[model samples]
Target: DTAVSQTPKYLVTQMGNDKSIKCEQNLGHDTMYWYKQDSKKFLKIMFSYNNKELIINETVPNRFSPKSPDKAHLNLHINSLELGDSAVYFCASSLFGENYGYTFGSGTRLTVV
Candidate 1:
């Protein structure tokens, strides 16, 4: 099984549609995260959760919401999607300790047309 997996790897939608992407990881880590990769390939952290609780928010817009049902699962919801919101989103998981690093999903490419 994949360390981290995201559903709907490709999403093509109209500009105003609302959509959600789901992620799950079996890494047995306490923390999971949502990250957005811009066209320029810069990955920025949008949200982080530890054991179903929100732990970090990296100044992401209100249009973007993250939910963690459990430590193994993290989902992202996007509302009022805009052209600017088109990007690749990645889900990742990692433990909080020395030498443990995040393992990322293959990524979901969202395009608003």
Candidate 2:
């Protein structure tokens, strides 16, 4: 079974369009995070959640948001998307510890035209 999975593996939208990516992890991990990979392939942390509580925001823009309905689900919602929002969004889950590595989803490719 897939440990972590995200919906809409590929997304193509126009500027100003709103979209959302759904993520779920069956690993029973309490901690989940959302990361964005830009065209330059630089990964940046967007948000982190621990058991439905927001833990880190990473200074992400107000247009982007992360919502965790439960320990196993963390979803990303983007509003008023811009051209600069085109990138790969990845969802990962891990135990709340440094030593425990994360299990990431395949990633959602968001292309804002």
Candidate 3:
């Protein structure tokens, strides 16, 4: 079974369209996060939520929004998709108050065509 899951592994769309990517973790962890990995393979943390509360928000565009319905789920929604937004979106989870490594989901590749 997968520790984390995200939909639309490959997304192809025209610029200016809105798209969303959903994520879920089954590792019984309290902290969940979203990350974006650019073409250069630099992964940056976008948002993180613990117990349904946002804890980290990095320098991301306003067009990117993160939603957490519960402790085990966090989703990312993007508006007015742009070519620069094309990247691999990864969902991850880690245990709070513990030095545990993050478990990453098979990323979603977004392409602005």
RMSD of 2: 0.6
| Candidate 3 ranges with C-alpha deviation above 4 Å | none
- What TM-score quantifies how close candidate 1 is to the native fold? 0.96
Quality of model 2 by C-alpha lDDT: 0.95
Candidate 1's error at 4, in angstroms? Answer: 0.4
Highest lDDT model number: 2
- Pairs of colliding residues, candidate 3: none
TM-score of each: 0.96, 0.98, 0.97
The whole-model lDDT of each prediction reads 0.93, 0.95, 0.94
Across residues 35-74, which tens digit of lDDT does each residue of candidate 3 receive? 9999999999999999999999999999999999999899
lDDT of 1 by residue, 12-93 (tens): 9998899999999987999998999999999999999988989889998899999888899999999999999999999999
Q: Supply every candidate's count of residue pairs whose N, Cα or C atoms clash at under 3 angstroms.
A: 0, 0, 0
lDDT of 2 at 45: 93
Give the residue spans of candidate 2 off by over 4 A.
Answer: none
